[model samples]
Target: ASHAEGTPGQAVAKAASAATPLAAAGGANHGARAMPGNALPPYPEAAREDGLEGLVRLAVEVDAQGRVSAVRWDARSGVMLLDIAARDAVRLWRFEPARQDGQAVASTVRVALQFRLDAPVGWVAQADTR
Candidate 1:
């Protein structure tokens, strides 16, 4: 499906599944997962006014203690404002760290954040493991 066309949630789901993996070659027994209640990235006013919409995929590094250590762009949303907004918000997210042999460990996970004008305010993003 074209990134520019989809129902609000469909865009995010498709983009997320297609996101490139930046994590290590071997998959973790349990991938880092986003904690509940993490705030959603605010949609940029400029992008909203212009009706810009797309999905931004990020490589989020979660430490063993469940804090976000770093974030890098795994894929751009094609809009700079949305990209920056997504990155900035994700930097503050906390995760349940990936586990290996039943012990928490640091790892990177792919996060796909969508920005759509049709979506309800504060409800247009989703995170996935990769």
Candidate 2:
């Protein structure tokens, strides 16, 4: 399933376990998961005014402390405004750190952010994985 297709403010986050086969195999290792109640990235006002909409794919690194350690784009939304907004917003997000043998570990997770003009202001839909 494609993560790009979704309602505005509805993001789909998926954890890629390429680096950790155990996580992919559903073993004791687990990938970092997004915590509930994290704020959605605010739509860029100028982009909204211009009716811009696109999906941004990001690879976010979550540390053992559940904080975002780094973020890099896996795919860009084309619009600089939208891309920057998504990146900045994800930076403030916290996650449940990946677990390895019952111990916390840092891991990378992929996030898909969709921007739409028709979405209700200040409302973020619940996130799901695809």
Q: Write the per-residue lDDT of candidate 1 for residues 1-130, one digit (tens) a residue.
A: 2333344422223222221232233355566767765666666877888889888888888888889998999899899998998899889888777777667888876777867778632322233432
How well does candidate 1 match the true structure in TM-score terms?
0.72
- Model 1, global lDDT: 0.66
Counting clashing residue pairs in each candidate, in order, gives: 0, 0
Error of 1 at 19 (Å): 15
lDDT of candidate 2 over 57-89, digit per residue (tens): 888888888898889998898999989988898
Total backbone collisions, model 2 = 0
The segments of candidate 1 whose C-alpha lies over 4 angstroms from its true place after superposition are 1-28, 121-130
